[model samples]
Each structure stands twice: as C-alpha cells, then as structure tokens.
Target: MPRLWTTRLLTALLLALLLLTAACEAEPEPRRYDFAIQLNGGPTGWPVWVEELTFDHTWWSPGGNLGGGFDKRPPSGGATAVLSRPMPAPSSVQARWFSYRTQTFYEIDLELPNTDALLQQWYRDYPPPDYRHYLMAGFSGEGEVYVWWRARCTVCGRDRSRDFHAPIVESAWAEEAEGDPGRYRNRTQEYVNEGVIPSPW
Candidate 1:
C-alpha cells in the first residue's frame, strides 16, 4: 500500500508540472498593430525589386518585414508594403532592392515624417475599439517620400485622412544613391515627375 501511495504521489507531481508548463506556453502574445509603407521607384530606377525592407521599431516579428507584400517582387515603377509593427510611427527605415533596369542591388535610407502627434489626435477623436489607425507613406517618382495619417472605423467603412496632395510631410533620402549607377539619377526630375503610381493611392 505504501509503495502504491508513493507511485501515485510521483504521478501527481509530474502531472502538476506538465499543467504549469502548458499554462505558461498557452499565454498569448500582445496584440499587434498594422502599418504600411510605399516604396516608389524613382525615375532612374524603373520597376524596383524589393529584396527586403524594414523599419526601426519594437519587436513585432523577425527579419524586419513580414516577408509578404511587395517584397521579392517588382512594384512596376511604384509599390509599397503594409507592415505590422509596434509603434507610434516609424520615422526611419531601410530598403534593399534590385533595380531591374540597373541590374544591381541598392540599399537606401528612407526618412519618413514623424506623425506621433497626428496619431494622438486621431486616437483621442477615434477610440481604438471602434477605429484603427493607418499610415500611408508614398515615395514620389520625383524623389520625395510623402506621408499621410488616416483613421477608419472598424464597424463602418468611414475613414478620415489628409490626402496625397497634402501629405503631412515628405521624407528625404538620408543616404545618397550610389549603387548600380542606373537611370535613377541620370534622368531628369521633370521626366520622373511625369511617372504616376501604378497602384491606386
């Protein structure tokens, strides 16, 4: 009888440990927010192929980007990706893309406008429970990156934002373009400006 009791106690202890581990593992991670950026191919770099892109932000996922949306593909002269990240809003970012026209990979630093204040404004007016915030950053073929702040209600399609014509601010290239020595710079700004975003803004 004593031996049976000893065995049962050992079994119970093992079962308790297993339950504790399972509970710890079952705990869900914090909810993540959504954000996106659009990388447009400048005049000289027609149809940029984004190999990888990332923003300097909190731990949301591995490899900087979610590895979907526009990465590893050509944006046909203009494209961007919607990324998920913990944020106020990322102001600094990096892009490594291959220019098919240039036939070389170029890494450029992208500077986005800071919109934390706008985000705060929207959050105060549009509570998160009923609304979600979205950021739209556009890289102009004219060599300017424009940013916009928008909020939309989850329940309804209703949304509010400052349109492309009036972007919060345009981000400039913190780094100079040097790699591949392609049309990205050889072309005229006026000509580049003539190119429009293939994807709907």
Candidate 2:
C-alpha cells in the first residue's frame, strides 16, 4: 500500500509541474512604443535642433473621447527642427516628423542651397490630403533665427492638441523662408482669416 501511494504522489507532482510550465509559455510579453524623430541631409555644417515641439496634453486610448472640440481646441501643435547653427558652405538639410499615435513617419522638411528641389520633394511626402496643414523653417528673416510650424487647425478654430502627436526633429537652426517656401503658413492663414479658425497667426 505504501509503495502504491508513493507512485501516485510522484505522478501528481509531475502533472502539476507540467501545467505550470504550460501556463508560463502560453503568454508572451507586450511591446513598448518609443516615440522619436530623426533628421538627415541638412546644411553641411548646421547642427540639428528641435524647439516648441508640443504633444497633446491629454492621453486617450481605444475608447476615450480625447476632447477639446472644434471651437476651443484644435488637434495638434507645432515644432521647429533644424541644424544647430547656419552653415556658410552649400549643403542640404532634411527633417522628419514622427507620429506615435498612428505609428507613422514623414519627411516634413528639407532644404538645399539655391534650389527648390528639396521643397518639391517635401510635397511628394506630405501631400495635401494626408495632413490638413503644413509649415516649415529653412530661411533667414528679421534676425530672430525664427522657425515656426503650422498650427493644428485652419478650420473650426479648434486645436486638436488635447490628444495629438508633436513633431520631433533631428536638426536645428533650419531658419524660416522669406516667402512661403512651402506655402503652408499662407494656406493656414487663409483658412484662419476666413473664420475657419478662431485665431489666425
């Protein structure tokens, strides 16, 4: 009787160990998301920089309302990424924007000395339909070293900033253009002036 009991106990222990191993193997670990931005192709000597890049103040997941409606808040903010300082030598600069919410990326800014070709390339990447507004900084003006981005909304006067993606730039000192190099600010301004937005800049 004692021998029989010992055999049964061993069998039960083995079964329990097998069950525990199975449970541990069944589930895998989840992946964490790291939001970031990268820059490539800027003026030869200019250093990369990012400023005023604001993300949505609030957080919302699958079923949340992520508020700040069309009347009060828009969906996003803006940032300026450029080379650290302007370089005298001829060079090209490229800036990229990252969207953590959608897991998307786009080449938003690019500048080549004495050529509009880089600007044209930017258009191909950020087509009119994909994003509502666009802004860039790659020119010198007024001695402020200013670089601005398009505000989130041109219509409904709301900033979608409550739960939106902010840009992360790789370079710095990518100055603003004298005229509308990309025409993003001008277009957004038009929308705002027409009461599309509560405030126009």
How much lDDT does each candidate structure score?
0.46, 0.30
Error of 1 at 33 (Å): 6.0
Per-residue C-alpha lDDT of model 2 across residues 1-201, encoded as one tens digit per residue: 999999999999999999999999886543221122111211222112222222122221111111111111111222223333322222333333221112222332333333234333433444333333332232111111222223223243454442222222223443332332233445334434665333323
| TM-score of candidate 2 against the unseen true structure | 0.21
Model 2 residue 132 lDDT? 39
| Predicted structure 1: clash tally | 4
- Residues 44-138 of candidate 1: C-alpha lDDT, one tens digit per residue: 43444444556663322122211122222222212444454444466656655544333445555666666666565566677665665555443
Best by TM-score: 1
TM-score of each: 0.43, 0.21
Q: Who wins the lDDT comparison?
A: 1
